[model samples]
Target: MRQQSSPHLSRGFSSYGCALALAALVALAACSKKEAAAPAPRPVVASIVHPDGQALQAGSLPGEVQARYSTPLSFRVGGKIIERRVRLGDTVKNGEIVALLDPADAQKNAASAQAQLDAAQHNLVYAQQQLERDKAQAKENLIAPAQLEQTTNAYASALAQRDQAQQQAALAKNQLQYTTLVAGHAGVITAEQADTGQNVSAGQAVYNLAWSGDVDVLCDVPESALAAFAVGQNASVTLAALPGRKFSARVRELSPAADQQSRTWRARLTLAQPGPDVRLGMTADVTPAVPLATAAAQHGLFTLPATALFHEGRQPAVWVVRAADNTLELRRVTVTRYDERTIVVSEGLKDGESVVLQGVHTVSAGEKVRAIAPLHPEDFAS
Candidate 1:
């Protein structure tokens, strides 16, 4: 009986062992499935950096449209402005009267000068008759030689006085003409310094005239940007008031000295051919089209698309791709500046290194990626 019971217990123990082995096999199969379901490396777009050959960027700055030949118009004589024939923004032809001074005093002086000349002429005639009579008397031995000498001296003095009166009359006529302030050239009035009923002195600027001619885009450049500009350099100008229109220009003048108050160099870009739409005092945007060689030297900066920039807190950073394995690593960079199209990286980037241009946010550290060439190198600059 004991031998039979031992065989039953051994069979039960064998069954329990079989169940434990099955459970172990099932656990092993679940572990294999989890390993197979592991996520694959995320695919991301990137580009190889050709930092050295990147084109130098173009820059834009605020500017203003101004007349190339602006001058202050003034009257040559002093008086009250009785009439202003031209108003601000009025176009005037050469020699066209712009303002008028009261002619009452000038006319009075002219009349007085004429009267004095008439009196002098009458005196000269009398003196001449007296001299002639004295000479005749002397010839006839009816008068002393001293009387003839006195008559001759009086005639000479009268002749001198007559000549002086004539000069005074001419001067008075000139003063009267000067009362009419006329435009020296065909131009548009930009400013009116004096108005009707206001007294102005000689040469006091009464009207600011902008001569009709070539136009200029005026801008003030800081000391740092002065090196980027030179005379004869080509540029493009666009007016804020006239959208979608671009005018060609060239650097015509550069101030030799910096402005004392602003410490900036005043630059003037003359338009090649300005149309009627281009008016004086219109705001403009001046973009200097610097040559690639000159620009590269002036701006030795690495440029990347603005999208490539990522902010880690307040710090700016970018994702650099490893060339060997196509993996990414977040790199902190010192940004020099940024414009509408590109971010200028001043430091923390080496030449000939790879950087992820797009999908910067989608990438993770050490994730594999596929590097694709950009459509154009300049796109990176943008």
Candidate 2:
């Protein structure tokens, strides 16, 4: 090609093109400057306020109304139900007739027993006369002593038969009395199964009666919460049907034994005035009384949702303020008490420090997070 083509000349020309292209790219990229990463989303705002010293998280539990006296209906003898004197919703007094059983067979047996007793007594009297005659003959040496003794034994056997017959008659009379059923207490009849002429076995229930006595609300508190209950303790009861009325009550009994299936103990609360308006089987609310967990003078105690609590091994800890930086702190807390809704934090928190009350599952100790207020301000109390 021409005089030794200038290598530097061609190389410089290629380098100049490459530099021009790179400069164009730099200018275009500057013009495009990528939008600043979208500012992080803001957390939802919440309303929080300081609580009063006397404020409390009043918790409630579901319970049922119950009668203090629940009695079973039964009969002493088996027979066909001839007449039913009472039905469900019947008001009855002590000794009132509830039902009647067929007494034909019983009466017949009783009459037969009496006949047997009379016959045995007559035979006994005749045997005694014969024994006396034989003894007198023995005294006159007309009969042998063995013969008199035989007559004496005959009289004794007849007397024994008479006594047994008499007892049988008495038992028959008692069985006949069972034919007329009677109420054992003043109560309102809750059920009646036996109808006229229905065959019933002994001790069969004919009526369900709820006796008049101290009414109560029975609540089965779980064994885990039973230790706080005792006899004579105070309770607050509310009826489901009557919304406004609340009856004060006293604990009648706290069963020491736990139910086999539910693992709960029965707590009986006697209502102060379970008015005539109250009915059996109606549902109620029973709240166990708790003593002041801390000093009554306490003010502004920390509170949190139970889910906000996380465990480190077996120790209970909560997320709290750590340092001047906005970092989460795993503050160990002494949890004194809790209800179904909220947990009571007794220690390890101060009044003004922010505590994570919710959404603790995503955050961890020393991690950075936005602090927000609780869902329900009323949940926290002093």
Candidate 3:
């Protein structure tokens, strides 16, 4: 304004001011650049599922193996044990001799009876000849009638004596046959009840045998489960000794009374065609198959790992169910059975429900918790 300033000087001042303003704007823009994008929100989660639940059938059961027809072996007549031909665990056929009683006295008695019988027979022949001679004499008038009558009576007496002696001989022969002990059927001798040289009474048990054709299993089932089993129900059987092998059996008999000590009942089952290797007294497991008509089920069961099981008043229970509105329900569970991994719940659960399988110790009723998604359920393998 003072010198109306030279045009070049005025232009240069304006350009310098413009350059300063532009620099200030660039600085503001650098400050306005956004911070790193925030981390994605953590996914909502519920209970974690380890393994899953499978549909259960009433057909599966725990059972035991047992012999269908087992009886003690013994002799019909009493005698001193002379020899035992078979030891424990020996198989024998029907009528096969298993043992021998001391037969010294029996043989002697039989021989004596036979000699007496033979002597009686000889006497009877002589008596018959004498009686015929007397009758002929009386007819020829050489003998008195009274004398003939006496001779006839004497012959009849001799015949009676001979018959009596013959019966005695037969008795001796029967006693001799009783000295040998034989098996009644093809079976395995499970035990030796008496030893050699021991005096045994008539019908005394000597050995226990399990017959081949008739085989059955006996199990002491819990009293509560006794009603579940009925005669003629089909079942599966197994032995802990013979792993991976299962046999078929049926409930043939049920004990009417329960055991006083264990509150259990005895159930006998018939086996289907046992093999040669199947021995008596071996441990067995029998499982009764539940007919589909009687098998019942429920819905909304919560699957829990076996580890979640803990004793509550000697009964099994589980923590179950949480609501988004912060409500909790503690449920007591009846454990049907379990293997290494899972516990089968018979009560206290509904399908598609949540349970505190893990973190059971940490969780409490009515406590607020962030629920994560449950794992997928598993399918059952045949």
Give per-model CA RMSD.
Answer: 11.9, 8.9, 16.1
| RMSD versus native structure for model 1 | 11.9
Best by lDDT: 1
Higher-ranked by lDDT: 1 or 3:
1
**Residue 14 local lDDT, model 3:** 97
In model 1, the clashing pairs are none
- Candidate 2 lDDT for residue 244: 93
- TM-score winner between 2 and 3, please give it: 2
Question: Candidates' lDDT values, in order?
Answer: 0.83, 0.73, 0.70
- TM-score per prediction, in order, is 0.59, 0.62, 0.57
Task: Tell me which of candidates 2 and 3 scores higher on lDDT.
Answer: 2
lDDT (Cα) of model 2 = 0.73
Which regions in candidate 2 have their CA more than 4 angstroms from the true location?
Answer: 1-58, 242-244, 260-262, 291-382
Flag regions of model 3 displaced more than 4 Å.
1-64, 140-148, 260-263, 291-382
Clashes of 2: 0
Pick by lDDT: 1 or 2, better one: 1
lDDT of 3 at 188: 81
- Candidate 1 lDDT over 1-382, as tens digits, reads 3534678899999999999999999999999999888666555555655442233244676899999999999989999999999989999999998889999999999999999999999999999999999999999999999999999999999999999999999999999999999899998999989889999999999999999988888998654455556898888888889999989999899999988766568999999989998889999988777643344445545678887888777899989878787778888999876667667686777767787787787777887666777667666654
